[model samples]
Target: MSEVLGHHANEILIVSIVAVVAVGLIGLPGLFALTVPIALFGVVLLSWVAMRQHDRRLCEQCLLSMPLNPSERAVRLKRRFWMAHTGSEPRFLIPYVVVLLASNFATTTTIGRIGWAVMQLSMVYLIMSQSTHRKLQPWCPWCSEGGGGAEVDETDPVLPQDDRQLI
Candidate 1:
């Protein structure tokens, strides 16, 4: 499910960014001024979808029953990183949309062009920083193979030990 959501979010971001750039390239004088704001709105939607997907994937992969014993410090740090990244999405996207909207009135001015460029750069930065960095590394073999060290009997709640019950 998260894989599907991530794919969709990326798809939206790519399409929206392309649309904004295409409008700028067409030299229509006023078209970019209008379309860029719409594209910025699309960026907000894209970011929300992507962040949700990232969280969902993290939860799915961190199952505790697998006994992989990830270090407590590492797990805590990763969780904090995820929270910070998720929290920043709205802050970046909202300003982008506002700037894009304001640019519409400036029409053929240098400010409008610069604003559009800034919006594109911001979108790229957000996607790379938030999504790529948080992606999970390779799966643990023990987790994937059902705790692959010792064979645990299906019926026993606990494993048998050398029955010496220490003195």
Candidate 2:
């Protein structure tokens, strides 16, 4: 998985970063309804690219799991958290993106509302499930291996031993 993702890491990172910027820009006063769909499209496109190839037959935890001891789990989770966040922001922001677009337009058709609601709920479920999986199993062997001892971001939180106990 890492080799596959690593092959396109730079390109995918750039796209996701652009999506993050677009989603952030969406709040500007002058950027209204148009920005909504554009930002939503950015997020949707990011999600599709990052996750579309995900095996539907298996959960993300299983797809991404790596076996590690307690200390290694701590080290690897801290190292890989940002990459996880990089992939997750688009997934988690769908609800806010849709609501912003809808509110900007004043109203949505019944079908549009239903669709947005469904998307929002689905993304929310996915985001929460991923977080829970990480909380339960902090180590990501693929991320640790792919990163090859990349410097840990100072801002990323390391789970304490007790916190790791929750899993």
Candidate 3:
């Protein structure tokens, strides 16, 4: 439970920090406020990537260093995958959206509006990429093996594979 709260706190912290910095650097422009959300989302994404990458490292280290039996390893991997799933699930996206939307509403901007626009569009790209990555993580041979999250959803987007992907 604490871990779940911790997860949210960490994400909120990242999003808030990035959003504030972007807002500060860009200066809140009420007229050009659209970009603020974009910048906030963009920085939030960068921070998310950094956090996940670190988690992946830990997963890999566990995979490589743990002396568990095959069954134990599988269990461990599933736990890790679910833990991540819990953290990254769509239900958790609400706070971020709300926060960014609120931030954008806080001020208007004129200068650097283009920069904000870029950040917003880039955030869309990042969101799409991460979405795809999330769907595919269960199937990703490397991620599953390293992050213990490689079990591909049985969904048809990716073909069924041998048990090797599970490992």
Question: Which candidate comes out best when scored by TM-score?
Answer: 1
Pull out the clashing pairs in model 2: none
Task: Give the per-residue Cα lDDT of candidate 3 at 57.
Answer: 27
lDDT of 1 at 81: 39
Sort the predicted structures by TM-score, highest score first. Answer: 1, 2, 3
Q: Lowest-scoring 10 consecutive residues by lDDT in candidate 3? A: 54-63
> What is the alpha-carbon lDDT for the whole of candidate 2?
0.47
- lDDT of each residue in 1-167, candidate 1, tens digit only: 65555545654675676666556645545676776667677785865677565544434433432235444433544544343344356885577677767765664777777666666655655554444333422222322244432222134335677668773
Scored by CA lDDT, what does every candidate get? 0.53, 0.47, 0.48
Model 3 reaches what TM-score against the true structure?
Answer: 0.27
Q: Tens digit of lDDT per residue, candidate 2, span 47-161? A: 5555434322234454455354555655645534554444356664665576645643432465554454444444444443444334433354544665643323244445566
Model 2 weakest 10-residue run by lDDT = 51-60
TM-score, every prediction:
0.41, 0.29, 0.27
Candidate 1 residue-wise lDDT at 65: 25
Query: Model 3, stretches more than 4 Å misplaced?
Result: 1-95, 111-119, 131-142, 146-151, 155-167
